[model samples]
Target: MRALSYFFVIFAIFLAPLGVAVARHLADDTQATDWRTARRDSTGIAPLPAQTPEAVIHVYAARAFRWRGAFGVHTWIAAKPQGADAYTRFEVVGWGVSQGRNAVRVGEGVPDGYWYGNAPTLIRALRGGDEVDALIERLRAAATAYPHQHEYRVWPGPNSNTFIAYLGRAVPELHLDLPPTAIGKDYLPDTGVFARAPSGGGFQVSLAGLLGVTLAAEEGLEINLLGLSLGLDLSPPALKLPGVGRIGMSEE
Candidate 1:
C-alpha cells in the first residue's frame, strides 16, 4: 500500500505539468486568433486573376466633391449564387483637402485586411454565383459587424489620388458644391469608359460616381456590372509638368 501510494503521487506530479502545458497552449491560441486585437480574413479578395468571377448580381459606386476641395469616394457590390436577388454592399468614405499636391489614400493596400481589418466579401460572393439577395444579406451582416472608426493614409499635394472602401450601408446623396452645369454629365459611350481625365483636373464618371455612393453605403470596394479597375502607382504617372521633372515611384 505504501509503494502504491508513492507511485500514485509520482504519477499525479508528472501529469500536472502536462495539463498546465495544454491549458497554456489553448490560451495562447485564443489570444492569437481574437479579432479585437489581431484580426484575420478567411474570405478576402484575391489578386486580379482570382477576381475573375463567373457571374455577379448588382454593383454600385459614387464620388462627391466640394469646391473647397473636399471629396468623397464610395463603392459597393452585391453578389451571390444564380438564384439569389438580395445584395451585399461594401462602402467607404473620405472627406478632407489635399492642397492639390497629392490625393488622399484610404485603407491599406493589403487586399485581405482592408474591410475594418476583416476580409473583403466581394470575392466570396462572386464565387457563390449570381444571387444578389444572399450577397446583400451577407454584406449587411459584415457591415453591422464592422468597427466604427479607423484611420487611413492620404495625399499631400494637388496631383495625388485618394481611395476608400465601404462595408455596408444605403447609398447617400452625392453632395457636390459644383453647380449642375459645372458638373457635366459626360456619360461614356461604352460603359467600359466610366471616368477619364488628364490625371490632374477634376473627374467624375456616372459609373464612378454611382459606384462610390454604393460602396460608401455598402461593404465592398469593387462593384457594378462593369466591375472595378483600381491602380495605385507609387511611382508617379507619366506626366510632363514644366517644373516637376517627371514624377516617379512604384505600383501597388
Candidate 2:
C-alpha cells in the first residue's frame, strides 16, 4: 500500500508537469491555427477544404462503466476536406459482456479517427475568422518544434500521428485541457492515415477495464445507448483563398 501510494505520488508529480507543458503547447499551437470561412461551393455542398490540396477529418469517443454493466456517453467527431468522397471515421465501442451485453469499444468508423489534430476545434476557430493557412503553418511549426507531443502516447511519440496532423503545416485548434494527459493508447492510430477495423474486439480489455473502474468511481456508472456515425464528402475548392490572414489573438 505504501509503495503504491508512493508510485502514484511520483506519477502525479512527473506527469502533472509534462501534462501541463503539453497542454500549454497545444493551446499555443491551436491559437495559431487558421480558421476559414467555409462556404457552399458551386455544387452547393460545403466540402472539407476549399483551398488546400489535401484535407483531413478527426473523430474521437470515450465511455465509462460500473460493475452491474452501466456505461457512460459515447462521443465522436468527423473532419474532412471541403470536397472529398470519403471521410475518415472514429468510434468508441464497449468491450465487456454483461447480462449478455457486449464489452466496451471506442474510436472506430468515425471520421478522422486516424487524425491527431482536432477538427471541430479547427473548424470552430476558422468560423471565428482565423486564417486557415496560417493555422496550418503554426500547427506544422509546432509539429516540427515539438515532434514528440501527440494526442495518444505515454511519452512523446507519433503513435497517435494522424492525417490531420499532416495537413500541410496548418494547425488545428487545441481542444482545451490545461494539463493534457497521454491520450489513451488504442485510440492512438498507427500511421498518418487510419483504416477501418478488420475484426476482433475494438477496445483492449485492460484499458476498457481501467476506464470502467475510473468512471464508475466518479459517476456510479450510468448505462447509455449512444450510437453515432458521420459521413462527409469533399468536392473541390470553388473559391480561392486570400493571402494568409493575420491571427490577432495574443499568445501566452
Candidate 3:
C-alpha cells in the first residue's frame, strides 16, 4: 500500500506536466509544418562575424523537429574567434548517423539557424577578447573528445542534448543552464551516477537519464523521470514544467 501510494504521488508530480505539454504542443500551429519544407533560415539573433571583432560564444536551443518538440528540445554551440569572418557551429545531428556518418558535426553555417522550422532561443552568450577566445578553444577540444561521436539516440541516452551536456561538464565556466526540456541533458556517459549539473552550479544523480534529481543555483531543483523534467526555481519563483518549460520568469 505504501509503495502504491508513493508511485501515485510520483506519477502525479511528473506525468501531469507531461500531459499538459502534450496539450500545449497540439494546440501550437508552429509545429505543424513538414520537415522538408520547414524554414531553416537564420533568425538574426547571432552576431555577424564580419561585423563583430570580438570573440563570441553562444548556446542555443530550439524545439525538436516534428512531434518530438512536444517532449524536448535540441541544443547546440556556436563560436566565433576574434576577428574571424565566420562562425563555426558545433552540434550532434542524428540525421545521417544511420548511414555511418559521425553524429558530431562541426562546420560553418548560420550561427542562429532555425532547427527545421523552430526558431532557436539563445541560452547563453559571452563576448570578450582573450578570455572568450580561450573558452572557445576549450569548447572545441571538448567537442572533439565527445565519447559517443558514432552514436545517436533520440531518447534517454546519447543524443544532441547529451552532447551539449557533456560540453557543459567539460567547460563549467560556460555555466550552461540547460532548460528542463533538454531531454537527454541528464545522460552522463561513463561519468557515473552523480555528476555536476549542466550549469556547473549544481549536482545531479541519474539512472541513465531516465530518472534523476538535480539541485543547483542556476538550474534550481529538477526532477527527471522517463526523460521529462519537472521542478521549481526559487530564485526567480518559476515553475519548470516538462514540456512548457520555465513559466515564471524571463530567462533573459
Candidate 4:
C-alpha cells in the first residue's frame, strides 16, 4: 500500500504542470459576460478575399466557448469548390439540435471565424486542384452521414470534434491530425472497442471514448484516459499533454 501511495504521488506530481496549464488557459479566456454577447467574427486568419474562385479545403479548431475552453477545442471543416465565390462551412452545433434542428450546420459564414471569441488554428489544409475537389465531395458525404446529427455532449462526446473526427476517418485523403486538445475527437459512434484512428493514418482501440489507445504516424502513440490524451510525437519529438497540447518546439 505504501508503494502504491508513492506511485500515486509521483503521478500527481507529473500531472501538476498539465493541470496548471489548463487552469491558466481557462483563466486567461474567461469573460465576465455570457457567451451570447461574446465576439464571433473573423480573427483575420481567413484569407483576405473571403470569396475565392479556387478549390480549397481547410479544417480549423478553436477553444470552446466559456468554461469549455479549458478542457478542449471546437473544430469545423470548410471547403470551396472550383470557381466558387464563397466557402461552405460544416460543423456540429449543439444549439441546432436543441431547437429541433440538425446538429450539423452548413453555412456561408467566414471560413475561419473565431469560435465564440476563441481564435482558431488551422489543423489541415489542401488547396486548388481536382484532387482537392474530389475530397470536397467526400467531405460533403461525410457531413451528411454523421450519425450524431441529433446528439451532442460537452465531454466524451459526439460533439463538434466528434463530427470532424468522423470525417477524418471517412475521408482519409484529408489526413486530418486532430490536436490533442480536441476532447471529443475520440468518441466513436458504434459499440466497438476498436476503430480506425481519427487521423486515418493508423489504428485505435477506444471504449466509448472513456478509455483508449491509438498509434499513428500523425498522432504517434496516445493513451486516452477519460478523454484526456497523453502521447508522444514521433516525427517532431514532442510530448502531447492534456492541457499544454504539444511541448518541444520544432524548426519551422
Candidate 5:
C-alpha cells in the first residue's frame, strides 16, 4: 500500500502538468486546420535580410503539429550572413527517414514562418556585424556535423529538439535556453549520461533522454523523467512544468 501510494504521488507530480497542457491544447483554436492545408506563412517576426544588411541569427519554437502540441514543441534555427540576399534555415525533420532520407534539412524558408499551422515563438536572436557573421558560419558547420543526420526518433531521441540542442552545444555563443517543453533537448549523443547543458551555462546528466538532472546558470535546475521536465528558475522566478512550459517570469 505504501509503495502504491508513492507511485501515485510520483505520477501526479510528473503528469499533472501534462494534463494541463492537454487542456490548453484542446482549447487552442489555431489547430483546427488539417496539416496538409495548414498555414505555413511567415509571422513577420524576423527582420528583412535585405534591409538589415548585417548578420542575424534566430531560434524559434512552436508547438508540434496535431496532438503532439499537447506534449512538446519543435525547434529550428535560421541565419543570414552579412549582406546575404536570403536567410538559411536549419532543422531536423523525420518526414522520410524510414525510407533512407536524411533527417537534417537545410533549405530556404521564411525565417520565422509558422510550423504547419502553429505560430512560432522566438526563443533567441543575435544581430550584429562581423561577430555575429562569424557565429553564423560556425552554426552552419555545426549543422553539417550533427551526428544524427540520418536518424530520428519522436520520443526521447535524436529528433528536432536534439538537433537544436546539438547546435547550442556546438555554438555556445547562442546561449540557448531551450524550454522544458522541448522534449528531446536532453538527448546527448555519445556523451553517455553526462554533458554540458544545451545553453553551455552548466552541466547535466541524462539517461537516454529518459531521466536526468540539469544544473545550469541559464536553465536553473531541471529534472527529466520519461522525456518530461519539471523544475524551478531562481533568477526571475518561474516554475518549469512538463508540457505547460515555464510559468512566471519571461525568458531573457
Candidate 6:
C-alpha cells in the first residue's frame, strides 16, 4: 500500500508540468462558444496544391475541442487516389451523434483543417506512383467498413482518434505513429482486452481506454491511466508525458 502511494506521488510530480502548460494555453483571453465560430482553415501542412494530386494520403491529428485539448487530440485520415481530383476525409465526431446525426463523416473537404481552433499536425504523408495508390484504396475500404460507424464516445473508446487508429491497424503499411495525446486511439474493437496496437506494429491491452499498456515499434511502450498517457519512445529517446505529450528530441 505504501509503495502504491509513492508511485502516485511520483507520477503526479511528472504530470505537474503538463498540467501547467495546458492551463496556460487555456488561460488565453480569447474564447468562443460555437464550434463554427472557431477557425477552420488549413495551417499549410499539406503539400498537395489546390489542384489535388493523385496517389496521396495524409493523416493528421490536432488538439481536441475546448478543455479536452488539454488532455488529448482528435485524428483524421484523408486520401486522394490516383486521378482523383479531390481529397476524401474520414473521421468520427461526437456532436453530430448527440444531434441525431451520424458520428462518422466521410466526404470531400479540406484535407487538412483546424480541429475546432487547434492547428492540425500532419502525422503521415504518402504519395508516389501506382504503389501509393494501392495503399490509399485499402485505407478507403477500411474507413468505410469502420465497426463503430454509428457510435461515438468522447472518452475511452470509438472517438476520432479511434477511427483513424483503426485505419492504421487495417493498413499497417502506412506506418502510423499515433501520438500519446491521442487519448482514445488505443481502444480495440474486439471483446477482448489484448489486441494490435493502433500502429499495427506491436501489441496492446486496454480496458475500454481507461487503463492499458502498449509495446509497439512505432509507439514504443506506453501506459494509459485516466484517459491520459505517459510513455517512453525508445526509438527516439524521449519522454511521453501526459499534458505535455512528447518531450525531448524526437527522431521522428
Worst 10 residues of 5 by lDDT: 30-39
**lDDT of every model, 2 decimals:** 0.29, 0.26, 0.90, 0.81, 0.91, 0.81
Model 5 per-residue lDDT tens digits across residues 14-66: 99989999999999886946878988889999999779998889999999999
TM agreement with the true structure for every prediction: 0.23, 0.24, 0.96, 0.90, 0.96, 0.91
- Could you give candidate 3's per-residue lDDT for residues 81-184 as a string of tens digits? 99999999989999899999999999888899889989999999999999999999998899999989999989887999999999998999888989889989
* Model 2 error, position 178 (Å): 9.3
137-220 in candidate 2: lDDT tens per residue? 454344444322323221222222222222211232432110012122213233322312101111111222112111111112
203: Cα error in model 4, Å: 0.2
What are the runs in model 1 whose C-alpha is more than 4 Å off? Answer: 1-59, 65-70, 86-138, 149-252
Number of the top-ranking candidate, with lDDT as the measure:
5
Q: Residue 231 error for model 4, in Å?
A: 0.6
Q: CA shift at 135, candidate 6, in angstroms? A: 1.5
Please give the distance, in angstroms, between residue 193's alpha carbon in candidate 3 and its true position after superposition: 1.1
**Candidate 5 residue runs with Cα over 4 Å from true position:** 1-7
Clashing pairs in 6: none
